[model samples]
Target: MTDTPGWASPGTAPSNEEREPGASGPTEPADRPGHTPPAPQPGAQPPGPGVKWSKEQPPPGQWSAPTGAPSPQQTPPPPPPGPGWTGQPPGGYGGGYGGPPAGYGGYGAPGGPGAWGGGWGGPPPAAKPGVIPLRPLGVGEILDGAVSTMRTHWRTVLGISLTVALLTEISLVLLQGFVLNDALAQVRVGNRAANPDEVFRALPDMMIGAGIIAVVTTIAVVIATALLTTITSRAVLGRTVSLGEAWRDARPQLPRLFGLILLLGLIVFGVMAGGALPGILVMAVGGDVVAGAGLLVLGLLAASVVTTWLVIRFCLSTPALMLERQSVVKALSRSAKLVRGSWWRTFGIMLLTGLIVRIVQVLIAIPFAVIGAAVSGDGITDLLGTGGGHTGWAYLIIQGIGALIGSALTLPISAGVTVLLYIDQRIRREALDLELARAAGVQASGAGAPGPVPGS
Candidate 1:
């Protein structure tokens, strides 16, 4: 095989066989017939005159070197010129015969570490400027980003979560301690009555109280989610935002965000109601009872499926609304667009997150609840014997405290996951990581930034 400039083959002596036509080196080996080796240098010193010549001499060309020249063991001259070669280094001018092409040392080019766009190894590691790397995220990565956001920006994240949790828990405690207590007392008294009307009449008061509590809690969650979404977005840019700053950024979109959430709830409720309507009407008209019951069951099942699908489809509406400053309708559309082909993946991630949140909430709340029940009532005996029928001030307060703490800790995780999931979806579909990289001011090639977004 022929040796090329700067890329000589291992263990092979340099040969003059393929040298350029007018090159100075001899084309044939000295052993070849009629091949004459170069004569001794004219200036070379002869052997000492007094020295006697040995009768036995080796072959003339064997193991020979010119008098003043370097042997193969010493530093070698530059490789001989070949076709299109200037005898320069292997990867310079005309590179080695099979070397990488020009511009191969670039970021994602063939010859560099990112050869074949990472086909030789793996794709270049994505840029990570903050809580998450700028690329499509795995489920674990999404969860970690949420936890990391809370860790990196604890002040803002905890502030929002704690404030919302406190307000919601306090309202619940007061309602349960005062109004709900009276309502429950009346219900218990009416339970002694044989009259069904009396028992039914006492139920609305408790239901109304529970409904008010739910509304308060929902509002609190909405506010927290809005603020936390903004904070997560900034965290992705490697920027810290104060609670007040997050509030200001989120304030303008609050009304629309509330509307978006309300609309989604209504959509699910409407679908469920519509599904049950046909069966309700059938029973109301005194049709075949068995058939009516079956239809009701089927309708309800269908409604459940539809509701779940819609929920996942619009799960990203919150982030879209807050970050894009979009109207309620537009945000829903955006979520639908992002979630179009990723329904199952989105559902799985959301379902897993929900399970994690629920588990954490239960784990944190259970101990406090046990303590509250034991302290408020006549201890564990009263709770276990009466099936937890008693509700007292101590129980409510203790339980509320547990709820407050649990909410404070879990709120950021849930909110962060949602926002990061939205961003991940966008990165997959819209190449959003490039924009994020630019917005974060990271120095990477081909990175871009969206135009100034409102509330940013």
Candidate 2:
């Protein structure tokens, strides 16, 4: 007779540690038909493909060892219903020699048992004692983590994002309020000039100013994305960090992260270019107009598909690069593996998040835009150039304030959800809960990460 570990289930024979002093393990019950087996221990490897996790048969010969010892040749029957396994509806009492009830299969297993019997080997994962419960997360939980992080570590999360947003917005406002205003004035004057050539000639400076704005804003976003990603990774483990600490951790990866974004951008551009090239060449060389258009559409469709795949494929790479400290290429490969079975789920969540963020931006911007127009109260003159291409300074400031607030809120949610999603994927695939618990200084124990408790 072998000694059972404390975490072993009812069907498994109990060791000395689990029983009362001088008590033997519970006896096996007589034959039963439909009893399900107990779940695997927290550390058990998931079953191999096509192999359902079931209680081991009592070695074909000996059954449970009775406290009173059975005589030599005769075998004891299966264990009796006891405290933890009293013929319970689903307490996972083991059945006779055969495995789990007929046709039992785990979730994702082929011909899996009915919904209630998802055939999961164990109880649903217990809650890991951390910022995020260590397990694959539902959509609501991922979103909750983002909000919870911000609420819990406002000093760090909001501080970093706020500083970034404020400085960027200030520079942007000044650039548009002063320099771009001058550039636009020339364009307005050129518009009224008798010679239309003047309008074309005056456009370059305005274009240059717009380009500068785009470049500066992009740099701000890239830096913020890196810093926020670092903060979220720690926050998920319930650790509070400072701005300096966050920056120190994130700074090393910023250069590579920036390059990764640029590389992704290039890939997307290449896809679009490749898709449209056929049509562009046909039109340039005087080929059939209809055929060129058709090819262009077809090429663009192909490009869109490829571009989206790349985007989803690498979606988890940023967090991988930061949290795992993996190189960019390795992170990308890691993300690809985690995402292999859940492409559509990831894609749908991402699309929904994008749509939601966009809607929020528009909602916030629209009211501010209306307020700006109302305050400025002179669009007609500006349009007619009676005001020298001027909309009131107040108008610009108000609009910028709205944009600033919108960005501050949106940036954290976007970055946090992305990182949490990455962590969730890893928990499901690589058993990241074990790593996260260790990081958070929580001991891994019999309990696994459980579903969110209502109202908790």
Please, what are the lDDT tens digits per residue for candidate 1 over residues 148-259? 9999999888988999899889988888877776556555542343354443344446656865776686567667778999889988888889988998899899789778
Candidate with top TM-score is 1
lDDT over C-alpha atoms for residue 159 of model 2: 83
For model 2 the TM-score comes to: 0.60
lDDT of 2 by residue, 216-306 (tens): 6655655666687777777767667889998889888877787776776677667867887887687569787667766866887898899
- Give all TM-scores, in the order shown: 0.65, 0.60
Cα deviation in Å at residue 45, candidate 1? 44
- Sum up the clashes in candidate 1: 0
Any runs in candidate 1 off by more than 4 Å, and if so which? 1-121, 171-219, 278-299, 381-390, 445-456
In lDDT terms, which candidate is top?
1
